[model samples]
Target: MFEPEKMKSKGLKLERMANRLSNAIEKANHNYEIEFEAANKYL
Candidate 1:
């Protein structure tokens, strides 16, 4: 049986995980940008 409640719960869990992954990626990108800017200043 395909249960609507189970599907919804699974969807919510996936969404939460995706959000965390994206946040981590954003932080990494921010750090990379800062390092790039500093390197650029030295050039």
Candidate 2:
């Protein structure tokens, strides 16, 4: 017995979680790039 609405919501939840993870990764990379540039300026 599969519930269509329940399945749909589950998919949406997974998608939202994945999107959050992706955004976090992007932010981390951006911060790292900024730090690297700052460090390079010291050399």
Candidate 3:
């Protein structure tokens, strides 16, 4: 019983970390797109 509870807690921690990493990647992509468009206008 104690073992299952510990496993569940570890799973939740991994899920949260994956979510944070994806969010950061998405924000970085958005910023890059904005910069690329602005650079094109100046060219």
Instruction: Tell me the TM-score of each prediction against the true structure.
Output: 0.69, 0.71, 0.68
Model 3, span 13-43: residue lDDT tens = 9999999999999998888433466587678
TM-score-superior candidate, 2 or 3 = 2
TM-score winner between 1 and 2, please give it: 2
Every candidate's CA RMSD: 4.8, 4.6, 4.7
Estimate the lDDT of model 1: 0.88
* Candidate order (lDDT): 2, 1, 3
Q: Who wins the TM-score comparison? A: 2
In Å, residue 35's CA in model 2 sits off its true spot by 7.5
Judged by lDDT, which candidate is best? Answer: 2
lDDT, candidate 1, residue 23?
Answer: 100
Positional deviation of residue 43's Cα in model 1 after best superposition, in angstroms: 19
Cα lDDT of model 3 overall?
A: 0.87
